[model samples]
Target: MTGRHAQHGLTLLELLVAFAIMAMSVGMIYRIMGGNARNAGELETRQRAVVLAQSLLALRDTVPEGGLQLSGESGGYRWSIHSALYDTGVAGPSVTPLHELAIVIAWDDGGRRRSLELTTLRPQRKPSPQVRK
Candidate 1:
């Protein structure tokens, strides 16, 4: 044969273009992954709020009537609960019965303040009838 056949390999220009495209694709994938990670973190933070709220509610249900305060932290999230005696319409000179309890959970969401509040009624005890003259 007068001339030899060219080798069946990619040209330099083709290789360069392929590399550029791959780089672009990798960058896009990394950006997407980062966004997803941020979203998952936010979801976890919200779930912590839910947990804190529920736990406070449970304590309010079980613990004796008094002031309540709790705080905790987890995975870039922090929470707190506050409880106090609330007016319940039933009032006496000495034995005023508080009726409602309030719980507030707070956290930081990307530098923004996020919070949830839950209010519950305390278990009521039957008031003994007063003797009349």
Candidate 2:
């Protein structure tokens, strides 16, 4: 081979190494993009779960305080509401009324069930007075 031609072109070994490096770089880029897309989807699911939990919890005021369990679905999520009278471990005062409310939101993620829960205590509503004729 001519000296000029040999010097002007990359050696076979060097070209192979260059191609290997480029392949590795492309693989890394593809993996990073795939991971980013998966993370975005997971984040979206988590955020929507939080919203569903919040909405279910907000219904505490309207829920029957005698202990109720309700189930429903919305926004690609399923939710359940559970309520029970909160006990302080002591005898009730008979006047103070309180309820413990729990809201659970669940969804299907990659064939797995993902869920979030929100819980709080709320005061019991007063009964309406009787009307006279």
lDDT winner: 2
- Return the top candidate by TM-score: 2
What lDDT does each candidate get? Answer: 0.70, 0.83
The weakest ten consecutive residues by lDDT in model 1 span 59-68
- The TM-score of predicted model 1 comes to 0.52
> What are the per-residue Cα lDDT tens digits for candidate 2 across 46-97?
9989977876676566445467788999988998888889876656557557
Give TM-scores for every candidate, taking all chains together and pairing residue i with residue i.
0.52, 0.75
Give the per-residue lDDT digits (tens) of candidate 1, residues 25-103: 9999999999999999988877787786676567555434555566677555455655566766667767545556566
Weakest 10 consecutive residues of candidate 2 by summed lDDT: 56-65
TM-score of model number 2: 0.75
lDDT of 1 at 9: 90
Candidate 2 runs further than 4 Å off = 1-9, 89-95, 130-133
